[model samples]
Target: MQKGSLENHLFRKGQEPLGWELRLKIAIGAARGLAFLHTSEKVIYRDFKASNILLDPVYNAKLSDFGLAKVGPINGNSHVTTRVIGTYGYAAPEYVATVP
Candidate 1:
């Protein structure tokens, strides 16, 4: 529980920056986690951001804070309609247009 968000590690002074390989690994892990949510779990992560990604001591990444997540549209539907809720500048253009 003491592990901090990726943002902390990235921006904190006096901390060594994440190496290229470790950064790549974290990116891949985050992608795989998001992919699993979108495909296997039918969930859309509306709040993907550095602050929402938690890292362990070894730098393994895991997504956290699903308060803004929503269930994906049912099969055969092009998109689901819902009021948009997430950090500003992070929402997709389509999502911004779709939200009232």
Candidate 2:
């Protein structure tokens, strides 16, 4: 995390924009991280945002802050019902409506 959060590199004033290649790499890395959490770990990442995505010196994206994470549905359950929690404007529309 030498580069800190991706949000800092993205929205801080006077910083150059990340190029398309780097952006794509970050996106892919983030997606892979999420996928691993969902599939292998069976965890629901309730707080996924730019501020939670840390970057290394080489710009590899890594997820951080699992405080809001929850164990996913198990057995025959289709979903887990829980109180909605996450940063404002970051929740999906379906998630906000259904809390699934």
Candidate 3:
């Protein structure tokens, strides 16, 4: 994302008015990135939301903050993370179930 490009949430505000085409495209890009992470890479993006979607000047979206992400489970050990992480209202439903 660019240094000063509009963020997904701020752009969504009616008063902000980030033209329709750009918004839609940004949304699509964000979805594709997430899909790549989950299906193609067999990973779980435990956190996702408009705020975390950083957009460039051309409305290109990028996923940020993978530092907390863990690789897919290999051992029989539980992936039931007890960390209780992620931003509110954007955390995956499955994550909440796994955590204490």
Candidate 4:
């Protein structure tokens, strides 16, 4: 079944705002999905934000929009250099700084 992004639920007008319990659960679920990506596959989700998280009818959260996801650094390198691209203010501050 088709589902909408978390942003849709949060920003839709005339609808009751999501309760704190659901919000907390969504946050925890999103974090778990992200943690799996990082620990299981070493993926860096560069575009992690509300818009990229979709919720099912029961409000189960899942990460989407993998276009910006990157394989993390290998061989013990400190970091990987790449073009800065992500929703403004959503990406971490250090990620937005252009590296020479």
lDDT of 2 by residue, 3-100 (tens): 98999989999988999999999999999999999999999898999999999999999999999998888897766666788986888877688654
- lDDT agreement with native, every candidate: 0.86, 0.91, 0.71, 0.84
RMSD of each: 2.7, 2.6, 3.8, 2.5
lDDT value, residue 38 of candidate 1: 98
Residue pairs clashing, model 1: none
Q: How many residue pairs clash in each candidate?
A: 0, 0, 0, 0
TM for every model, in the order presented, reads 0.80, 0.86, 0.66, 0.81
Q: Name the better of 1 and 2 by lDDT.
A: 2
Q: Report the error of model 2 at residue 48, Å.
A: 0.5
What's the TM for model 3?
0.66
> How far does residue 84 in candidate 4 sit from its true spot (Å)?
1.5
TM-score between candidate 4 and the true structure? 0.81
* lDDT string, candidate 1, 3-67, tens digits: 68888879989988888999999899899999999999999988999999998878889999999
lDDT computed for candidate 4:
0.84
Winner on TM-score (2 vs 3): 2
Pairs clashing within candidate 2:
none
- Taking all chains together, the TM-score of candidate 2 against the true structure is 0.86
Residue 10 lDDT, candidate 2, scale 0-100: 92
lDDT of 3 by residue, 1-100 (tens): 5734345346545656666887788789989998898777857776676767787766788888786566666576555666877776667798667765
| Candidate 3: residue pairs that collide | none
lDDT of 4 by residue, 1-100 (tens): 1558888778889867889999998999999999999989999887888888898878889999999888877898755666777888886788677645
